[model samples]
Target: MGETTQHFVLLLLCLSGLVHSSAAFVFWTAVVDISYYNNITNDTEENFCECGVYGQNARVETTSGIVVLPRDDPKGCHPDTVYNWTSSPWIALVKRGSCNFSEKIIAAVEQGASGVVVYNADGTGNSTSHMSHPEAAGVVAIMIGNIQGMEIVKLVNNGTDVYMTIDVGSPHGPWITSYWLYFLSLAFFIVTTASIAYFVFISANRLYNLRMHKRSERKLRSEAKKAIGRLQVRNLKRDDEITNSEAHMCAVCIEAYKVGDVVTVLTCDHIFHKACIEPWLLERRTCPMCKCDILKALGVEEESKDSITTTLPQDATVITVAGGDSLFEVPLTEPVRSDPERQQHRYDNRAFEGDTEGRE
Candidate 1:
């Protein structure tokens, strides 16, 4: 039993990890404003695909913040070197390196950056790696592909003042569905083989037990039959009230209990139809007249004292809230019921607060 439980726990952990990891690996895109360093006065700023360009140079601004670089060198900071970001509160533009994208973001954050915009450090074209900063609290980070990064790097190399507004969306990575399938297959194989082996071991142990103590086995079987018979008798006695409750009528709706309809058989064995008691419980979990284990029937151990009131019966048309557990009651009059379509339209327009209240 303990070994079986351990295997179940292992299966659950693997399944949970697979789900979270797969969700994290979905494709994500980042949108940001790119300013070229060469064309400072022209301000030919535009949105570019982060994955499309290399060596991208970009700046981020808060309502009030300053750009600080490592070495306290305010000017001529090389965006390509990851070492340059250890200085101050400036946007650290780093080139893509062999390190994971997360590692680059951490390096920049360590230097006290308000945000980090990682562009392609390489010459040109698109590139992506799983680069994210683990401790990036209140700091934004973006990874643009090589091509776009390079254009920004050029603008910076030309001494252009680059600034950007970045909007980061979802994470991008490999599909983990196959890994999930693999995990499930492995779990199935383990469980199947374990079950077969366990069955064989149990059969062998039982055979040994029977051979060693045949008389004891006969006595045990006889005692087990007597215990089971006693349990059946006790259960039969307890079921007498339920059998006798067939004639009870719901006090609230004044309707006779229907056969095959589920009933909230009370502790007192006073059976009430489920539909009749459902609204009553929603308003109050206690039995309508005799307050008893109504909530227990609903599987609720604790309940608030507040009882929700059911809408007073309307002629018959009711609007149901989508996905909501409660049923709404709307009265339908004869004139409105004559044309079902018109009645429904009126109900929709009224409930939705649309124009054409009475003008329909």
Candidate 2:
């Protein structure tokens, strides 16, 4: 399996084990009720109290019988210990210590005892503990406090016919105990921390990608500026065909060229007013007439050779007008200006002059 799947499986197994262990630790209380004849008062007295807890491996059910104590040993430690009671149903009352709880329960079960009640050691008072008697399965066994057990023993020894009933009570463990709140709080904390951490990771990744995209756009715009500087610029004269023809107009500004007009020739052989097209090229990096990428055409940016073909006709030629003379020739294949400061100055002057004339 993959590493993530393995970790999930391991976590599930651990949780399952924890639940099983917690269940094992859980124990049920026993509602112990006793009735006897009060000889001095000449009346029957009964007492009911939830003062006992069932053993881990004992049967959690109701059982009633006369309370009987072992004749030889109160702890029921000896395997041969016997009971003197001749009743049809009886529950053995044993003391703590001297032997394991399983042994005491087993001794009582072998002697026809319907149930077993084990009391805690001395000085423990009314506080009882959950008992474990794995070896004595299927027997109804519970543990009562020393004080309660001693009271029942005294009544039985005084020749009073004391009848006891043990009933299953409520279950108690980590889920219902004081630890429950702490466990729930810990789980909530873990879930909240994981959610916050995942959200932060996603947000950081998106921010990083956005920053990278903006940086790339700025770099491409810078490259487009460099490519625009290398394009050819010419000053139009009155004798030029473009200045005389009404059909020829700059795409940007949508006006026919005039005498002394400065224009930039694009790689696609389409020309536009230098002032209008420079800003357009810097922002869009493409010819307005044919939508051709100037950066790719001028080799300033990398693109496939097959995709760089311009839309201009095969017979197209560059036009240059100087001193009222028009000359048709192949477009400039070399860089127009090599020095950065000279190129920037020339481009700025030509754009300023063109703008000034357009306004008038």
Candidate 3:
């Protein structure tokens, strides 16, 4: 039975060691990262400080034990009583008296002790009091039993050699925890990289699309301008052609008037193709040139008040005249021979001469 118990205890000790080793690995390997001003910059690096190790200036606490040291000397106290309740680096022995644990510790701090170990002066059970450097200075304090206090006090009084030890808990740092943290940090890095890549791609795509749209709009505007210019050029050409046709010849669809056609003269003397002017006069009763009122020109005194109608020609005649083609014919539509001894008088006198001869 004794051997079995020893084996079980050894196994428990081994398990405890493994657990501590694992904890140490995890703490030492864990990566700490800091990110500041994320919008402006992303700078990250590994932290090198071991998480499981304590620094020399670290704050710590002591187990249950009364401390004894010089209380009034500033040189012996690590931190002066002004800043911390007690001076550090020496055990303090405080007797339980008229004050509570808080008061006792305050007195001990005022006396410049490194650590405070308060003990009950009258009672048997000494409630362990944990001391804190409420001032944020690193002073370790603990409480101990009356017997422990008396032992330390006896050494202080007798001037005998005494040594004190403090046990502080250490962090566990192991390899597995280090690797785990390292991988986690790596994963975070990959994710961050992918996110940045995606953002860049989307921005580039948007910029490209914007450029393309602008280019397309520019092209469309250019084409429209060209079309408008062409249309204006075509209109100008058409106007020039119409002016030339009116100057050199009549309109292509209508010929000029022949000699026999009835003619209405305009005040401006700008004659048009008769077929064209006839339709125009029927619609507007005015000469095509100078906008002269044709009815007034033909002797209507008040052209606007009168309903003028066209009359048949009086003494109108047709005289055959030569034109371009072989004996191409033309006619005079008005009485060109208006003299009394002309053809009309000759025809009238012949009949009279014949009547005179018959009477003789």
Candidate number achieving the greatest lDDT relative to the actual structure: 2
Worst 10 residues of 1 by lDDT: 52-61
- What lDDT does model 3 reach? 0.39
Go through the candidates in order and give the clash count of each: 32, 0, 17
Tens-place lDDT digits, model 2, residues 1-360: 233333343345347685565567567789999999999999999999998999989998899999999998999989999988877699999999989999999988899999999988889999998888889988999999999999998998899989999997765666544345345445656887999999999999989877766666677778888998899998987656667654456656656678898899887666789998999887667766445668888877543223333354443233342323322222322233346456334223222344446647
Q: Model 2 lDDT vs. the true structure?
A: 0.76
Pull out the clashing pairs in model 2: none
Give lDDT tens digits, candidate 3, residues 181-276: 445446656887999999999999989877766665455344433332222111112222222321222221233333333332233233444555
Instruction: List lDDT for all candidates, in order.
Output: 0.45, 0.76, 0.39
Error of 3 at 123 (Å): 27
What TM-score goes with each of the models? 0.32, 0.45, 0.26
- Write down the RMSD of candidate 2 (Cα, Å): 16.4
Error of 3 at 173 (Å): 7.7
Candidate ranking (TM-score, best to worst): 2, 1, 3
lDDT for 358 in candidate 3 is 49
**TM accuracy, model 1:** 0.32
